[model samples]
Target: MSQGQHWREQLHEAAAQGDTASLLKVIRSAVAERADVGDYTLMSRLLKRIGRDEASRAGLRPVRVYIARSVTVESWLPYLAVEAAAAGFWLETKVGGYGSFAQELMSPEGALRDFNPDLVVFVTDVEDVAGGLPDACATGKPELVRAEVERGVKTMEDMLTAFRHHHRARLLVQGLCVPDPPVLGDAGDANWEASESRATQRINEQIAALCRRLGDAAFFDENRLASRFGKARWRDERMFRYCRLSIAAEFFAPYARALTHSIKVLFLPPHKVLCTDLDNTLWGGIVGEDKPSGILTGTDFPGNCYRTYQRYLKQLAARGILLAVVSKNNEKDVREAFRVRAQDLALTLDDFISLKISWQDKAVSLRELAQELSLGLDSFVLIDDDSVECEAVRQQVPGVLVIQAPREEPWRLTECVMASGAFDTLSVTAEDRARSDEYRAQAQRAQLENRAASREEFLASLQIVCRFISALEAPLSRTVQLINKTNQFNLTTRRYGTSEVESFAADPGGLALALRARDRFGDAGVIGIALCRTQDGTCTIDTLLLSCRVIGRGIESALLWYIARWAASLGANRLAGEYIPTAKNQPCADFYPRHGFRPAREAGGKQSRICYVLDLATQMPEKPAWIQTEEDLNNEPGPSCARVNEEFAR
Candidate 1:
């Protein structure tokens, strides 16, 4: 066999034997020879054989890539990359050491320009800042390290700018992983970790700031992951494990893959709604029999935990996850708990999209809730403290994700859920932070409409403003979010990735617009999004979705009006859209007809598509004064208005 084949066989054998030293030798040898042995693809295939394809597809596989030349990089990069890749990601494997920050930053841009990639993964070692190693061993001295780190930061910023300017590639910045201070003899001495942790923290902070400024990049916390595994394990084992030959080459493979998988999942959007149980789940006891004061929420050790869990849920609600109650309890008791005793409760009934408190099977209740919220069962997560309840829902509802509550240690419930990492995302937008308040306002609007006697009167009283703007060079995070989470008001129900949205906007034929609404009750944040493309002077709506909280207020009509007007301004003669229904989007089945668009075609099943068109040149109805003009819309900073205050009061 040729030398390349010989090394490949050696690697395969080392991987099979789980020999760490042999594996490292093979990897190092491959790197030394610059042998394009396709190790990443080989490892990914092997992982897929074990039914662990999630990580492989994410591109976290073993391959050498140029990392900064420092004692920390020399010590940690190989293992970190292997673990991260095995966790999933096809890593670039070009091993060359950089002596300075400017070199490190500029090198990648040249490499990227030569070899175009969809994503770039950058890792920095915390040791550069933490400072225990001698000056000769580290990349730069204490005083000089700041400039080096800044250069690295600027390099990333420049690279992202280039990516946006050229290929529009996505960037994932991995935080520096630190050695356990205790294990490294730096623990408890405040100063030991102070300089190091602070340095690493500063680098991460810079990285995050860059991500926000760039608008498309994401920051991943490698230190957080390393911390979770403990400093002792990272120092004593991880640092040296990948360097030893006798250890199984593939022993850390799973861990690497898991890390990559976790990062990829973090980038994926999260579920929009949470379906939770009441008794012993949200609180410590049954509300039906126990007096509001009798419930064990918000007091001692265990109660504190339950309260902490509720607070976390409230935080989640604030991030725009529609909270709904699915419980088997007395309706009056539940009502009193939130109304009278819930001043201390982390969440209230007003926060939920739907509340079903009856003896009905939870699976059935969930179905009803989905219908009410205009969401799919797949988009909902079911949380209950009872194992039987969790299992029953899982068995009955195939798509419903069931999360069991902490039965024995009720206080640990919050930690358990958080640990599951169900809600982690690459970034959170301003719209997300105000989600709970928006839902609360939505509930009040519903109540008012029910009593108003006429839809027109209720809408008129709303004094709602619907603003539309042509897509700019702004971030697509909010647009991507609405596409993923919205159901009831989603006309086409098509979800797009960040990259896809960017591509759509760049296309001359395509169109993207954001819709914001506010009323006397409160500002609803950015509640609606629509993306379309023009063909033969006809504008076709590729995506149309709005948050449920802002529905029933004539905002939909206002939005359509804006689209029609925009199409006319663009000199398009016709406006086209589709109605593809999901289980939760039945509410919008008749939406097009109501908006003066007629179906030109139809198909079958959930996959069925419908096409509609309207002549933009034809005079449309007078734009509602309540709808804010596009220019006026840009003046408002965020969703802050009396509408939110009124909703909170209600």
Candidate 2:
């Protein structure tokens, strides 16, 4: 039998077996094999009997999503579940009452409040909230447009805020969809004043702005998604008439992907670097064979595709995704191409954080690159035109995400990577914008470290400074980002959302401190966060995490020193720290013990959780001598370390 027939036979057998193990295993294999979405829609029918919590133990992270919509979404739930599962999430979904999203969202005793979802999705359209918007557009008044935006946005904000008071779920709000053929016809496009499209776009802008102001909320542009799918086929009148469905059944999978893609970026940890191949991947020809000036990369037929890709890579670098060159070309040829052919290229020599151009195996080069950048292999995404190299890396360095750029359609490489969604992030901040430059600075630091004779001498010559600020004064977005993503040096390995971070920062009986580090090289923005709660006479550490970028720089030491002093100043005589073991956190197993924290035998420890305690009135940890803390330069002596010990905070 053919391979396709054999696969179909296995899928049918697995479904007929009627067991959770077989069903889940087949679904995962199908997703990896790029099976049709309709297969998943049918396979997920058996998921009704599989326990959501059981999925967690079966190697999937279980997440509950509350989808609130005015239209009928029952027919689309299976598609949504299967798409979200592709991102390592097993979905448990709750659907809000039809045409009652506002009441369900705002009511404290509503089903939404009881469901306690990890994400709350607002799938709405202009026709649902502002049905009069079309009539308002028919009248050529800008004030009516403004009034509709204001009314719709305020109502959304109110319901979202009310729901926020009860749950910490991150928000994913869909924007207003401007229906395909203008409701007012060609005359509507005569000018901006009469354009229904312009009015709908204005409302979408307000919705997006509201999400940003809400903090931890993300916007999904339904109109942009509909526009990509032929606007005329976006919805089916038959489905709408029978069940009030918002989109066509045939395109339900794509529609579901639109929503889950937003969810993946919001809750899933992002890849830090994009390691790309050079020969035929970045340009139309190999650098060595093309001889510097012969590569096709200007404004021509196939050349334009390469040039546009180069421009897109620059944009990704601007958003803080580090770029690197990973190619099996001579270093001399690569440098000569960029150095001499500068005018012909959109990319320059300084764009990449690291360049691996040699005869070494790509997997070996990737490992070396990870070590040089102080990042984990899992935090990388590789794009290469050569399928053999892609498969080799996928086998040798299994953690890395490999996107094979087919040689036949080089122009579609960017589209394939976008579909992979390897670099999706919840939000891009100023720190993200400065990421590539900071890594470049790290290379400079590496050079200085090599020049110094001893480790102590190297640290002292760097002039590192640590700035401590109250978490309330810090940007909660970055703080929460660090909390969710940092793993190696994290003591508890606990993840939290913006709402919980805000509550901790505002609590009168708590302490939330964030640490920012800078040196002779550059500023590593907000690298560490420590959350504490003081009750009775003891200060307990709830979460302490430091970014891998500053892992070996004694930054965590400086942070711990400051926290110990601050807890003493608050009149607490004892401090407590917890260690939760995970696969990625072996580096932090001895963190508390290294900082003069002894095992708290009085507090019984479990097999998985260990507790440590430090005497605040007596055993103050010794601060790293090479680092200069903000408190050290202060004229006022707010608090002092009670004692010093031999332990290092490394």
Over 14-89, each residue of candidate 1 has an lDDT whose tens digit, in order, gives 7788554455445544533444325544533443333323333332333223433333333333444544432223
lDDT of 2 by residue, 377-432 (tens): 98899999988999899789977989887667778978888888788876788888
The local distance difference test score of each candidate is: 0.61, 0.79
User: Compared to the true structure, candidate 1 yields what TM-score?
Assistant: 0.68
Worst 10 residues of 1 by lDDT: 635-644
| Top-scoring candidate (lDDT) | 2
The list of candidate 2 runs beyond 4 A from truth reads 1-34, 46-54, 57-59, 139-146, 190-194, 601-607, 631-650
TM-score, one value per model: 0.68, 0.91
Model 1 alpha-carbon drift over 4 Å, by segment: 1-141, 154-161, 180-189, 192-194, 235-267, 285-295, 318-322, 332-355, 452-454, 470-476, 491-511, 532-542, 549-554, 576-650
**TM-score leader:** 2
